[model samples]
Target chain A: MEGLSIKQRFQETLKSVYFPFVAIVVSLLFGSVVILATSSTSPLTAYGHMLKGAFGSIAAFDSTLIKAIPLIFTALSFSLARRSGIINLGAEGQFMMGALAATAVGVATPNLPAIIHLPATLLAGFLGGALFGLITGVLKVKFGASELIITIMLNYIAKELISYFVNGPLMDSASSSYPQSAPMEPSARLYKFIPGLNVHTGLLIALAFIFLYYFFLWKTTAGFDMRVVGFNPSAGAYAGMSIGRSTILALFLAGGLAGLGGCIEIIAVQGRLMMTSFAVPYGFTGIAVALLGNLNPLGVLFSGILFGGLSAGALRMEVMTRDVSSSVAVVIQALIILFIAGRQMFAFKRRYRYRPSSEKRKGKTVVDDATEDESPTVQATAGEGE
Target chain B: MNEVVSFFSTTIRLAAPTLLAALGIVFSERAGIVNIGTEGMMLVGALAGVIGSYVTGSAWLGMLIAVFVTVLFSAIFAYFTVVVKADQTVIGTGMNLLASGLTITVNRALFGASTSPPEIDSFGIVAIPGLSSIPIIGPIFFNHHIIVYLTFILVPIAQFVMFRTNIGLKVRSVGENPKACDTVGIRVGLTRFLSILYSGVLAGMAGSFISMGMVSFFTEGMIAGGGFIALAAVVFGNYTPRGVMLSSLVFGASNSLMYRLQALATNIPSQFLLMIPYVITIISLCIVSRKSNKPLGSGKPYIKE
Candidate 1:
């Protein structure tokens, strides 16, 4: 490890940053083509409006930040589970459960001070999402049910649960026409920092979590064990790490983080829960967010903000240009995921000038490992390389 | 007796899309790609079918266009998973999002917001001359859209092709062990690409049936979760065409039952009625998890050195 120089370390980090940047640019370029084909307005004009809409003014920046808060938490949820080698697709459901639990607690508590009530609601949100995640984790461990299918089923169930509550039992009596909950009392609501700006203290919580994510995952022993299990369960087992326990724990944390995101969206932003909520695919978007961030804590922060900016800008572009649908943001996001996932296709050449031949040899071995399963060819290749 | 006939007819009608999509998935899974993007591919097909029909004033043209466009989309999936060695599940999810976004964006652009697009001519029930007179089976199966008949016929065809052909052997071999297939001189990438394209074509046809055969107009997200249910059918069917067809019938029957229950106007909440199919899928999946046998390399991407 000590044999690496400063230049090599810089190149490695730059390589990590390069693909995501290229992916974003390529996606946006492809997006321009879509806009050109569909709408009368030029892609440049629409994109110009999007940029202006996202960050041209203080209010725009504020909206972008506000929109990014839930994404950050959801991305954190996804990245945490990915680190443990579990693809937690239930973030959408867990986030909804968190919002539901927070709304329930917030509506019930009318006398507590801000400090007490806020923490209680947050805890409720975490527990709700955690329990939801635990169901999938436990199912996978005990019954071997694929989390992918289970989580998708759970998301549908969660959506139905929310719809049932808002329409039947938890409906606001004062607003009979609308299927939504009663607004939270002032004591429970998150305070806005700037006057007249929609930005709230939830940003602070998200930032704190970003740091905690870095510290907990990189600095803690448990986090290391989870990552090891994720990388290779058999190897982790050989190293005395419990794969099942790590799986469950990582998912729990993931769900709790996403739930906290849901809680914040309700308490700090929306104030009440609607039956038809999450007009956007925030949970799915978070997958892209985690991947674009390369599953790094700080990287998630930037990618979350970038996506939030896109979301905010796309809405404005739609409003300003009547023909442009905000759903184009979805296309751009999908394109980003495609490009990032297939970054190997865009690799021009290896940058390790000092070790290009050896690196190419290593790359060949990796490809062999990927396409083959215990074949003699793999062994033959490995022997020749050695 | 009339209600039973109506129920069976509706069940077959509803099951057609899932059956078609699952049939396509069987090919891809057998060749080593899971192709979860069927939902997205179906969505694109549905919308494209409507657009094609509206433009050409021919529903058949719409179905053709749906297949063509969806094949293009599947090619993208093929490029990413088969050639680029990306994760299949993630790419599938991305495809879904892309389809959802692109369809809405294009729909809004083509036909402005809020106003309903003009309805185009679509496939209707086609009764067979002699078969329509069969006592029990006539109305239930003999009298339906041409797509429905095509779907049923495709099942047996799929079974035959998958079980008794050289290509099928190559595809299954690639999935079971790509390394061995490669050693034996099979073009693994090309086989996977063709298999994925089969899924793409069928999913598009499934989408076209929804927009043109079942409903006359395309709405945003008209495909809904039909693709996902098809995916479940693929799983429940144990990766066999006939098995997938049977599982699709079960889901189709549940859908038909839901419509019937709604017509009865019972006091029960609609949400619970909607929940029925999903609940059944979850339960079935849990039970099947104990004895499941997915393709060995179903979700893995192949990367040759």
Candidate 2:
């Protein structure tokens, strides 16, 4: 790969894209079967409704972007942590903590100027999520706790914390028994940037972060060190890189990104943090998005929008097709992840047929070419070769 | 004395589902597969149990159906992780999402988004005739749901089977070193696959215990981190059957105490009370992680070269 021409590298990347494309198509096909079995409406009709709902109008596109903004943020969070070799399953908790902190800051000081109030609220949200994510990193490094289990535990704990706050200390008194916080001050709100569209400045923020994600990972020395550690922890340690620092810093940034998403979601879209705000599962959906995008920043942007379309469209599909539940979106999302992760299921028999002949050649250049031809399959099988 | 007796009785009852699932975890983890999908499998089992009883009107048949469905569900997980050599944790997360979505979709499709949960035949308490008469021991140990007794009885059997049986040795060997097992003609993939399916069966039974044995109906997200708690118990128990039982009992005790505090109308918020088990799991994991005896091949895809 290092010796490959620029065009060859670009072609290789493009070839990898087809795997995710195939996964999406396969998942949607499975989803159609579910729709056919569960509802009276034909799968075609249901899908038609979904398409119309997602892209038939200016309003629908706006809804798609609005739904996608948070997903992109969370996808970035997952992608960053993953690139650094840590599976941060606590994005859900981090997102929640972010929203919680944003709410606290957004509502507490109502009279401040927008510049200070809004940034402070956003910063608070980021800090909240970062701190939450740091717990997993700290526990893993210090106590040898499995981040997989600990992150899951933190998710439950965070949910309870939200329930406790919304039901008691932070409950909006003027709302008369509702378990939700008061609306953010006008200064703290994120106003719409696009003319006549419901989408907020969050879209701009998402785009900026996407670029930053690309730049930081590809161009920065710190990001390179983190990636090296993620690729081979022992080797990185031998090379004098601090695995702990990379892990801790990666999680902190990852949490902060997701937290920023939560903050933006509250200020731009929901207006107030409610118990029901998390019902959509932005964090988990972001995982699907991240995987679909192959963990590329540009790929994340597109997949995020694609998932957002699914969500926005499913609501309309449910309304039009009374028997089809909107949860089909979730099924499709999960299926995509399954298909992407187990992509070997889709690998062609050509690989098997080609391998023996390649081995017969046994020339250095020929073997390298053979490996290059089967690079995707080899990478898929050996990506986690630790 | 009555409070103490009832408390002990309640602890066993509360511990039954998690205990059942943890026993299953012991088997799967011993064979080198981390059954993170246990939570998802349990959720699917709970729904299947209700559906089965709703259709058949027999609680026993419902339990059987639950196990059958979960075995099939876990088979998909096994195929992906074991056969395709995908990352076990990634596939597990997918299974969880799939289960959650599938359950809700199927439930609403069948029940029409109804507010009232569907009613079905639930397991009944069975007391041994003479054993019921004993003052403290009978009620606490003998008189309760049949699942409770079966769960407690399985602990010793699991301990014996795991430690003494040849099959158990093969499973432990596969988990610790799959490559060596493969060289010795042990069929590592098949052992891990079967171990996961066995875990699925117990997880399904545990799910049935929650929806049918403990209550008469299934609710969305009813497993409510019970699977995770069971996983925590597996770690806290040091990967041994007896240890898992003790860890599950401790969790159950904390859960029972939370309920009691809620019943007594303590100043502590009910939400915080509900958080006790999860909090305890985290704290316990921290303490137990230092001396971890986790399977060497756990969470790794065993690719045959």
- Candidate 1: where is the Cα deviation over 4 Å? A1-4, A350-386
Docking class of 2: acceptable
- Measured by TM-score, how close is model 1 to the native structure? 0.93
Give TM-scores of chain A for all candidates: 0.90, 0.90
Residue B58's lDDT in candidate 2: 94
lDDT tens per residue, model 2, B78-139: 88878776767777888989999899999999987877987799999999789977999988
Tell me the spans in candidate 2 whose CA falls farther than 4 Å from its real position: A1-10, A349-386
What TM value does chain B of candidate 2 have? 0.98
Residue A6 C-alpha lDDT in model 1: 95
RMSD of each: 4.4, 4.6
DockQ of 2: 0.47
Per-residue C-alpha lDDT of model 1 across residues A1-386, encoded as one tens digit per residue = 26779997787677678889999999999999999888888999999999998998999999999999999999999888887778877899999999999999988879899889999999999888998999888877776666777787788888888898888877888998799998987788898998889899999999999999989887999998987777656667889998789988987899899899999999998899996567777788998898898888888999999999999999999999978888889999999989887776566533312221222221101111121111112122211110
TM-score of each: 0.93, 0.94
Q: Give a tens-digit lDDT track for model 1, residues B66-138.
A: 9999999989998888877677777888898899989998888888768977779799889999998898799
